[model samples]
Target chain A: MIDESRRVSMDIHYEISQHYFKEATYLQNWKLREWLSEMVDEEILYWMPIEENRLVKDRRPEPTPDDAAVYNDRYKHLKQRVEQIYTGQVWVEDPRSKIRYYVSNIEAFHTDVENEFAIRCNVLVLRHRRDTQIYQHSFLKEDLLRKTKAGFKVVRRKLTIDARSVQDKNLFFFM
Target chain B: MSDKDVAFISGAVRMYRERRGWYRSVCNVFMVGEKSRMEMRVMINVKELVDLENATQAKKIFWDQDIYDQEQERIFGRSWLFLTHDSLIPKNGDFVMSRMGEDKVIVSRQKDGSVEAFINSCSHRGNQVCHADSGNAKAFTCNYHGWVFGQNGDLVDVPLDTLCYHDNLKKAELGLRKVRVESYKGLIFGNMDPDAISLEEYLGDMCWFLDTILVGAGGGMELMGPPLRSVLDCNWKVPAENFVGDGYHVGWTHAAALQILGGPLAGLAGNRADMPYDDLGKQFTTRHGHGFGAINDAVTSIHPENEEYADFMAETRGVVAENLGTPREELYMSHWNCTIFPNCSFLYGTNTFKIWHPIGPGKIEVWTYTLVHKDLDIDVKRSIQRQAIRTFGTAGTLESDDGENMSTCTDSNRGFVTRKGRMNSTMGINREGRHPDFPGIVGASFIGETSYRGFYRFWAEIMDAPDWEAIKVQNDNWDEIWRGSEFWSDK
Candidate 1:
């Protein structure tokens, strides 16, 4: 179903995937400042709306920005979170927890905006803390990546977390 | 002075303080089990577990499975539990699945525009019906055996009813078990115990405090949902007690987040600043264990994005003063962290409504929603929702800090010696008493542990009382412990 105008070159697709992997590397290594300042667009919209379990027949529309969400972040919100971690008073993160990021299934398309690609990807995050505490999270992400002078910047990201009731103590970690 | 009766109070408690003998006098009421299970909780010698006099609770209360089972039946079964709010299920046939203890319930709006709830289990063979979190459906058809249940949990159809067994199924007797349902303001709650007091009565003086937020400016409040759900590995009571009156933990526990956000409460980070803490707030506890700690002029303390919410409070406080009077007006402009007895809790200023549903003694499932005034501008409501979720939702900055403390507090009791150990909440032992304007025990400061004492006081009372009848007898005398002191008058 690829339209001729929107299809991207294979070379561009490979570049975008590699860029996403590097972005994941910054987050997995807790280089949150670099992730924000380098990889994210200043006008980025990052959100994770609460997913409700409704019947297939239910016709209610998906949640908008006004509805409940786990993470509804602007650059400032993301910056505050990063600064919070760096404050050295975040005891929970101090007894440093281990984390790994798995990114795959990249499908990129050219959008109407010049140099902006609409991308869909799958992410699996694994976290382990304090001896036996282990949690796995999966998400399907829809992102808009802008090819700017600084390289690919995530302009917008909307993640659909797979868990109906998240099993972890908190989802404070980045996805 | 009402103040003349201050001799009975002490700042340090070395032994159980003597006041009213109501608890010790009720020995005859402590019977056990199938003489109506609500009539007794044999294993939980609540007197030893929750020592209100010393303000200490046994560590085992958080780890013991026997106590957890007793709670599942006695406390959970006999208490009014928070269910879905009407806003979430506004239309007829709209329903949401809820949990009361381990029991799954479907709360649905009926054809007559009233709400009804019933166990989600299929009446026959005990299979689960209606697995969706929420939906609009006339009937829930169980995949197994094709049994169908109506919106009110009435068993309507069965496969081969006429052909199989010649219609001996006795369909009328097999409706999913019904729970007594009631609404206070717009929030709906369910009670499994037939003998439990009406929801309004169960709410007790907590309603007086609730009116400050719920009915201030006349529109009342509603919970925004598709709530954020997550698991916390801690005793249900751990968080319950925290919200009840653990203001002590906030500055230290949430310091980083507060520092990053830099709101009015940022001064509280690390408890480093020696500010006028006592003058800032007060704590309150009702007859039925419901309680709150309210900080003066803190309505926008935690909200870094607090313009619209602050404006709403500024506009509404006068109207609330005109309607509910000056005392309530003060409450309207304050930040509050409260628990509605056994389980439900919320922060009014922060607007994060929560329910700590017990999974076992050492674990809980937390359901979070946004609480906002019904008639506010949609944009303002969304702003409050966003801020509330950002601070207290599953992925919240502050919530992450709390999860570790809660889990460790419960997990500590896993040690044999630790299980026998006792935890102290005697922060303001002699500091709270009756107030002329406030309807319950008003404490010296919001940071004090008075509400925790009051909370465990009722926990002991309920754990000992066999049924609501025994509870009713002492209802008039519930505040006997504070009967002699006059913090308001003396101060």
Candidate 2:
């Protein structure tokens, strides 16, 4: 008997980790179309909200999808973004930024829904571009995944980047 | 008399004098440069560097540290920098960390709803006093010596004053150096130089244009923050100039994104020759280096899905027409890429506000915010914000598309010979001139580099002028160069 809100079994945790790794692999290899089709749910809400630096004592509510966010994207929005990559006129990626994604500390918890699992993980991505410049991004990613007939699908993914100010030119690559 | 305590009074005066003298030196040092006034005047002949005749800028401006440093002294020092908006800090004690050139600043809203700013440095020892990006606080306490400053930046408390300094610390004189702040509509701006003109006057004729969006509808606009911040390897001016008036790059630089983007302007993918070279829209350049290039009737064009914004804009267009007039009504419907001299830029239609804070000559910290109408439906505002970031935020499709070009544009100048070369912006130079309806020097088409030259023209003036007084002298004849073309009279 799986209690809702309880941590999932080790087998379920391993299963979610494998699923996350595949999503990371699809992102790393520039297989965005496949990533979306195979790993993402049609009603997915991919979000990355603008987080302010506030004092520990300050209790203002955190930003929601209603506020300014880097990626408050729906399935259609994500599809459109992914479509631009395959357009071939994308000159910036022609030389191809060498990117490696590391997903770790993944934990799975049972959600209210029978097949759905609430997941949390840490993602560290390193990107090397042109000749010398390199960029690093660390994120605390909160995700909701569901076990479907076709395997696993990401229902939601909210990424909180660690750095207050991004050191890179842009966060173009998937995390 | 004998009761005067002569030694104590004299010692205090001497100490006060000593403190005053040290502060004067700190002011000169901290303000970037006042001691080396002549060096600023003769260091670089900006007229030579920014050639009005050629519409070319020296590549050195993008790569040289000396040129960049001079800009911090003249351009950033003299300029009215964008601070925060009223909507973001609705409550008192709300604050945000900002920058003026390289100097760190703390912008705070007081209990009286008045906004104030500071240099963010401690009065003693120069250690950073306020560390967080923003928060509610009664006072800021220095980590070093526990020196406490009030919400208005007045020094109020210090650690063990009697035990430490015999109770003689001058708290009144040692408050965090205040900056001159003024708000235009709901948008707040801070100036370092007290002698500089008011923010409204500094905006010049751009204020006339800004009012279309800022006040055309009933409630005007408010910015959503904290902003999307990222560092880009490019001169602050590069993006500033681009947004000021580089409509030419939209089709080419964002070709990939546009090919797939099903929008009104998607026909512009790859800068097609058939798109009417001179009929696209108009570019306007006002005094004080502020400028914009307007693309015709494409408000909310980027947000293809949210026709709610388009519908809301259509509804507001009538109100704007009634309140402001026909020109502004038409402006209300149009999309614009604009910059307020130096480094603040925004795309009106896209509603993406940006502050390009310079890190060095070839690098900048790009702070991005979403500007929304105060009266728009909450859903519409949310949709607009999403679309704004999707195209212009840190990982924006279009924004992602252009970062490489901006980086490479500055990177090429790293070479010795390359740094000495000239880069041309001479597109549609003859097509622009004065206009009857508009107050500024208006160009024939949006794609022209007419505004680019105008931007550089004022840039050179500000960089070379010794002070605001010197700049004020040339104000009457500032647009004399563009007036030579005489396009409006012929039209």
Q: Which candidate is the best by TM-score?
A: 1
Model 2 chain A poorest ten-residue lDDT run: A1-10
lDDT of 2 by residue, B1-491 (tens): 24366556555655764675576556556765554654443446576789988799998888787788889988899899998888877788878889998899988999888999999999999999888877788789989988998888889998898897898988789999999999999989999998998899899899999999999788989998788889898989889999999999899889988877778889899988788857778999989989999988888888877878888898889999999999889888999999999899999989899999999898899999998889988888888888889899999999987788888888898899898899998998888788888898898889888778888999998887767866775666798877577788867
- Candidate 2, residues A61-90: lDDT per residue as tens digits? 988888888888889888888888888888
For candidate 1, write residues B32-85 as lDDT tens digits. 323453333353567889887788999888888878878887789899999988
| Candidate whose lDDT is highest | 1
Candidate 1 off by > 4 Å = A1-7, B1-41
Task: Give candidate 2's total backbone clashes.
Answer: 0
Residue pairs with clashing backbones, model 2: none
Clash tally, candidates in order: 0, 0
Question: Which ranges of candidate 2 are over 4 A from the true structure?
Answer: A1-5, B1-42
* Winning model by DockQ: 1
Judged by DockQ cut-offs, the docking class of candidate 1 is high
